[model samples]
Target: MPMTKFLKNDKGLTLIETMLSITILGIVMLGVMTLFKQAYLYTVLNEDKTIGINVARNALMYMEKQNFIEIKEKFASLGNNGQLQLLVCEHNGSARYTLIDSNTSPLSGCSDIQINDRKYNVTIETEPPKNNNSDYANYFIPLVVKVTWKHGNIEQSTQLKGVLTSEDIR
Candidate 1:
């Protein structure tokens, strides 16, 4: 009779039922936490990729501002000390603006930058002019600016390509 009474008095969860429910909830919570961790990792990686693109763009802009004829020379002329020298020459109506002088470099430059504790290695490249018969082809050169950085254990890079021509429309 006492056992029957005890069985009839059951209310809410028994110890075994409570423990099982808790275990199920813990498993679900673990899955949710793992998902959140993966999402956060992707967000950080995307941020680094975007930053790399912006860095490449800024380097391209700087290249665009340099003397169009000497952009290629400057890229190839980095000194042993790792410094890019800026060459300035003024051609008053009296002389041809030729950069092939034996005493001077054609003119190319490189620079390193850091943002948000990330270091960037920037490089510029130029290729021979394509086969366009336009008179302006002599003044055209292909340009590419690349920015690279280490994002955690992986290496990331971005590039911007363009054609440089004489700044003078005439």
Candidate 2:
């Protein structure tokens, strides 16, 4: 009988190849997780912005309920910067709230969110019309409240405007 040559060939991945594939997959997964984390942080920052705006608006609403003259006086005491003004006082007493920008007293149980190493800016503005009862006006003055904050690379603002009527004042 003649000797026959047997054919053989190496197939599938070796140990090193398997390890290299797993490493590549792991790197991809890590990158994805990093991206997800960044996105979540951005979302949280945005939520803060919204809350800051609402806080400012609520403050303004409280001011609106008071006498027109008292509005300016109380607001003056409160900080124009919005972030620093968390309290307003009258002859009776003072009310305390949270200032988004105020380093002295920040939101209760809340911490600052820094995205791209930038701090948020929250501002409030109250501008009354020069004329109290104009042809098309309802009140003596109009109060304008502006709230501003920064998220990532975008600057956002929310404004609340109301008219101060004689009826509103006591």
Candidate 3:
């Protein structure tokens, strides 16, 4: 009879135990949600950075392909106080490039670009080869290209530098 009474005393779960399990599950779920949020943010940031890099690279390549002599002549014609301008834009999901001279009165071209509904600003700065050795100055020109854009109220930028050598003129 004592064995039968002991077997009948079994209870599935107490109120306190049920509440405690619920609380633990809630905490774990909250942590997992936080992790997921962080991962999403990281992915967005990476995408933006990748686009900026590509813009800068394309600008560099465009400059590299130009005839150095004609570039120099164009600069001279502007009295050396002008800039070589490149405008990049997105049209129907494709990028288009336009080259212009800063001296032109209607100079509407800017380094800013719009890609995939996002706006990015790109700037290219060139330095006439340093005159350390007069001959070396004639042989190389230094260039820096920067890409900038806004990300969630914060500004981000990427820069690339290269030297155009006389040997590349051909």
lDDT of each: 0.63, 0.55, 0.72
lDDT by residue (tens digit), candidate 3, 1-170? 59887567676777887999999999999999999999998998799899999988888888777766665566556553456556764556765676566445323333457778778776666666556787665656577777888987999999888766665444
Q: Write the per-residue lDDT of candidate 1 for residues 1-170, one digit (tens) a residue.
A: 69887677758678998999999999999999999999998998789778878876766666667686565455456322232322223445332222232234453332246679987766555654566666655566566666778977888888778777668753
Put the candidates in TM-score order, highest first. 3, 1, 2
Model 2 agreement with the true structure over 54-96: per-residue lDDT tens digits: 6556756665566665554544555544323333222235333
Which ranges in model 1 have alpha carbons more than 4 Å from their true place? 1-10, 72-111, 128-140, 151-155, 168-170
TM-score of each: 0.60, 0.47, 0.69
Off by over 4 Å in 2: 1-12, 68-125, 128-133, 136-140, 146-162, 165-170
Residue 75 in model 1: shift from native, Å?
6.8
Best by lDDT: 3
Better of 1 and 2 by TM-score: 1
Better of 2 and 3 by TM-score: 3
- lDDT, model 2, position 71: 50
